[model samples]
Target: MAKDIPAVAAGNQVRSVAKALMILNLLAEHQREMSLGEIAKEMQLAKSTVYGLLATLRDFGYLEQSPEDGKYRLGTRLFVLGNVVADSWDVRKVAAPFIQSLVDELGETVHLVVLDKGEVLYIDKRECTKSLRIVSQVGTRLPAHCTGVGKVFLANLPAEEVKSIISTKGLSRYTKNTITEFHLLEEELKQVRQQGYAIDNEEIMESLRCVAVPLRDYTGNVCAAISVSGTLSRFEGDELESIVSLMVRIGREISLHLGYRA
Candidate 1:
């Protein structure tokens, strides 16, 4: 028969650490702001232990007490950490010149995007020299199935994760051209993987057309995408092909500079 180890001697420390991490995760998921009693009940931990952890976190500035109700919430430390991560991305540093050159050569708007959860997050953009413009802000997020950059990123994801995301964030149609059906979107993604590029044929906005190429990382994984967007009237046949080639080239260049091989 196996002997049972004492809690204090062997497993108590690990259990305590696990509980503490669970508490932190819960707070983060809830966007912080929880009363002491609420936190203890949610974590299924003793009130004394929860208080000790909260006090320690407060001392370290990882949490703060609400001025009005004495509830606890995430503190400035998280903002400082988030800023550090944003600074590290420094996408503009590497992508700006390429985007400028593309805009000069193709006379179209260029955009850089990264996948965040189920959305395409715009990190950088360069508007065209043309008088007619397609407005897109740097911090804007859009549905993955309806945009060029989003399609490229989604094409590279594993099938299971794609299905999961689609199930959670349903394929909402933004325009008549949008591919809202799950099976149809899957087929589109397969074509993108085979062709090495994606096209947004007025899927997100009427009369707007766009093309995108995957931006890979050091592990040869698609981590982001670069795209060129313009009016459908301006993008047709040979001109569209030219812009697609340029975007693929620029995306590869940026990916390589970011340590991607292949």
Candidate 2:
């Protein structure tokens, strides 16, 4: 009887499926790992029921439980699936040619990054052939406040949201040039917003400079950033300005390709 409609299911079956999906959604929404009790409380479900569902999910590789802390998180299976989905609509794919061009033109390392939970996640990198590049991996995550691309993405958000992110992530010092105070960072972000670009002046690594530009989507929201990094000696006064203009121009081109009109 239920064969005609593929979507049709018994009430109990549908309820079970919904509950399982809700657990997955919960894990996706939360930034940190959660305990079974916390998930049960958050979802208003009984501990026994939640534990059963979580155990089933964990056994199937959809979720993983930490042995040290007894916390649960989305497992590597989801990450594998996410990578598949990510590839289908990857901004890195659209920006690859342009990024390669920047490296070819500037002979410096180029990075494409996006903000993930108040941190910068590098999605793509074009290395300079001249052996003058920053030692950053494609999937490396760094504090958003300490990088030029991170600051570009950060400058696009609201003050309240920015404050919330800062509170959650905290301003941990990485170097002497890294901004550790909220007030000072705010002032720096204000300048970045006004200038339409951001610069990391030996902040992440001593004497390593980076200039970044924002990449906006079709809706004019900043979705990512592109940065060119090299040593300070090669990126001094006039050279720095030239590279900034070139990067910004190329960045706008990539944004347009990603469906942004302006």
In terms of TM-score, the best-performing candidate is 2
lDDT of 2 by residue, 1-262 (tens): 1122124344434665577778888888896799988988887888898898899889989999999998999988888987887687558789989999898898889999999988999988888779475678978899888899989988999999899889999988877999999999999999999988999998888989899999999999999999999888988889988998998899899999989996
Question: Candidate 1: TM-score?
Answer: 0.69
Error of 1 at 250 (Å): 1.3
Q: What local lDDT score does residue 148 receive in model 2, on the 0 to 100 scale?
A: 97
lDDT of each: 0.83, 0.87
lDDT of 1 by residue, 166-198 (tens): 898889988899999998999999999998999
Each candidate's number of clashing pairs is: 0, 0
List the candidates' TM-scores in order.
0.69, 0.71
After best superposition, candidate 1 residue 57: deviation in angstroms? 15
Error of 1 at 131 (Å): 5.4
How close to the true structure is residue 116 of candidate 2, measured as C-alpha lDDT?
90
